[model samples]
Target: MRGLVESAEIVVADGMPLVWASRLARAPLPERVTGADLIWSLSELAASRGWPIYLLGGPPGVAARAAGQLVERHPELVVCGVDAPPYGFDACDGGREKVRRKVVEAGPRLVFVGLGFPRQDRLIAELRRELPDAWFVGCGAAIAFAAGTVRRAPAWMRRSGLEWAFRLVSEPGRLARRYLVHDLPFAAALLTSTLLHRLTTAGPPFQQPPS
Candidate 1:
């Protein structure tokens, strides 16, 4: 199997189960790469390396607040900009186009997108042609965590693969189907597929190198 390749800089195993499974399979992975952690870690790295970042998504003031907090935490970090825009797939007409243009013009080294699932993933993928040099990642609600609106699960809970439960409890209505139905089944299927492929294949599983 492809194992998981990203056209961007790096793809961390954000989900707890994926992190543990990768360890079991002996796949070298960075520490559980939550978006918030990624932001902070990358911010520090970028500061030393002189890489700029852009934060896209979050509710109205959330992105701005998150950017503020990030800059505050890492005073040397260079944040190109922060914009929230709309949520649904069909962004406010030219909104997505405008964002794409901004990213290209800004020439940032990293672009953290928070539109959540398929939307953020698809948007970043689509923008690849325009923003070739930028490492665009779909960070789900990482921005909210940075904004202090949501709390991440404790280390133990995260390691136990019950971070979803913590989040479900925090925002039950928004995440009912996501945790209980959508992600759970999807994750199960992914695990089954990975294991089956590993057992059946002769060669070692491919690992994506840092971009």
Candidate 2:
């Protein structure tokens, strides 16, 4: 996963914690740029430019619903295809090839994949080989959010960087361990390390010579 991200054409800070870490490191980023927001903005650009797009992932029928929403918003947008592959579809070579062929045949200019993390990113890498001219985004749950199958945090929560709390409350059973046990500790450690690095590298306090 690290190699894949490092090799990607571009990467952005998708969470506020990452943005904060950048500031602590003295290399501040503009802001978080989330996939949930990108789906709309990118579709708008694709519409204006006449770039056909493909939607992949989410539960059955969700990709289609998201496609509908995008088209409704941008009447000029063309959704070339939508696919919601079965669970573990990428587990076998045959299944991966099947979806790869489907997307290539559709010949979209852009592809939004919402299969989550390394899986979606891995598939995007493979699909890029078959459709070298196409652009791909590993969009996580953006498709479901666009389709209204999953509710996104309110705008205020998102702006305030409390969106994770909203999601944790909404899906405690699925997310509690990830948020509390794994992510929380990792975030704390990251901030701590950044602060330590900054402090250690900082020069000594200025002293005025006797006047």
Q: Give the CA lDDT, 0 to 100, for residue 105 in model 1.
A: 81
lDDT of 2 by residue, 4-66 (tens): 999789898888889888888877787999999999999999999999999999999999999
Compute the lDDT of residue 100 as modeled in candidate 2: 91
The digit string of per-residue lDDT tens for model 1 on 47-147 reads 78888889888889998899889889888889888888766634565867787777788888988889876677767877777867778867888899999
TM-scores vs. true structure, each candidate: 0.80, 0.94
Checking candidate 1 for backbone clashes, the offending pairs are: none
For this target, which candidate reaches the highest lDDT against the unseen true structure?
2
Poorest 10 consecutive residues by lDDT, candidate 2:
202-211
C-alpha RMSD (angstroms) for model 2: 5.4
Clash pairs, model 2 backbone: none
- How does model 1 fare in lDDT? 0.79
